[model samples]
Target: MIEGRMETRTAILRAARTLFLERGYAGASVRSVASAAGVDAALPIHYFGTKQALFLEALPSMPDYQPLLEGDPDDLGERFVRYVLEEDGHLRPLYLTLLRASDAGAVGEQLRDLHETTFVAPLESRLAGQDAELRARLAAAVVGGLMYALWVVGDDQLLAKGEDDIIRRYGALLQHLIDDRL
Candidate 1:
């Protein structure tokens, strides 16, 4: 019974994540997620309370390249960039959902709180040796810019070339901006 429940929860989350990314909060309904998950419409609400809650539950709570953060900073940057360029990178979908939600006042505030608490806090911890707040903010800006550029440009040519290429180009640019400013 417990195993079956867990499987259903996982399915709901998977469906919710996909639909939320594809349709944003406004367009994605609890019914839609439940249908996608092959469950009753009320299943989402029963498991997660509300559509917004389910959406947050489905969002990436951490970057997928967490192990890289435990290694060298340079290596981390390369791995992070590579992960970003990879098909269906965890960060990209969440980033897109948040960006889309930002247009709705209440949803935007909710997204901001969720991001600052989960996303930003983790990155800030990774930047601890680099003067904490400054490094974190700089890193956030760089990531935001890169994500926005990738979304707008609709191509990963620059990102897909190689991790070495991303590091040599964007990493150097980011390091100069942050290190010099610090």
Candidate 2:
């Protein structure tokens, strides 16, 4: 019985990730995920509590930015850019999923909260200046655009460019913000 329950939970989670990716959070429903998983709709509710909870659970775990934060302040931008471009393959889907569903009602709220907590707040704490919050937000926006262009739109030109070039250019932009030069 325990094994059966575990399988059911795993199946539901797998289906949720697939449907949520294919159709944004607004479009993907517990019913649909349950259907895809071959489970009763109530099972998802029972295990995950709510669609928001399920969505959060289905997302890839957030990468730890602590190491990036601890690195040399001068190299923070390059570190961030390199981490996203090279090490954060698992996070691509999460960015797309959040972006696509951002305009939806509760998901919008969730996205805002996630953005603040995950990206803005930590970076904000590291920044020095009266406009630290604004700078962090601006940097976050650049990161978002980069992810969207690379993963969602699949910009061929950008994709064709070497990673080093992107790291240098984007890193400088982020570094400017980090340094409060802008």
Top model by TM-score, which number?
2
lDDT value, residue 33 of candidate 1 = 92
Model 2 backbone overlap count: 0
Best by lDDT: 2
Candidate 1 per-residue lDDT, tens place, 65-125, comes to: 4465566765455555555666466667777788887776656777667657654566667
Task: Report RMSD (Å) for each prediction in the order shown.
Answer: 4.0, 2.6
80-161 in candidate 2: lDDT tens per residue?
8888888645687777888887776677787888888878999999999779999999999988888888888889899579
Give the clashing residue pairs of candidate 1, or none: none
Clashes of each: 0, 0
Name model 1 segments beyond 4 Å from true: 1-11, 64-66, 74-79, 86-88, 103-131, 153-166, 177-182
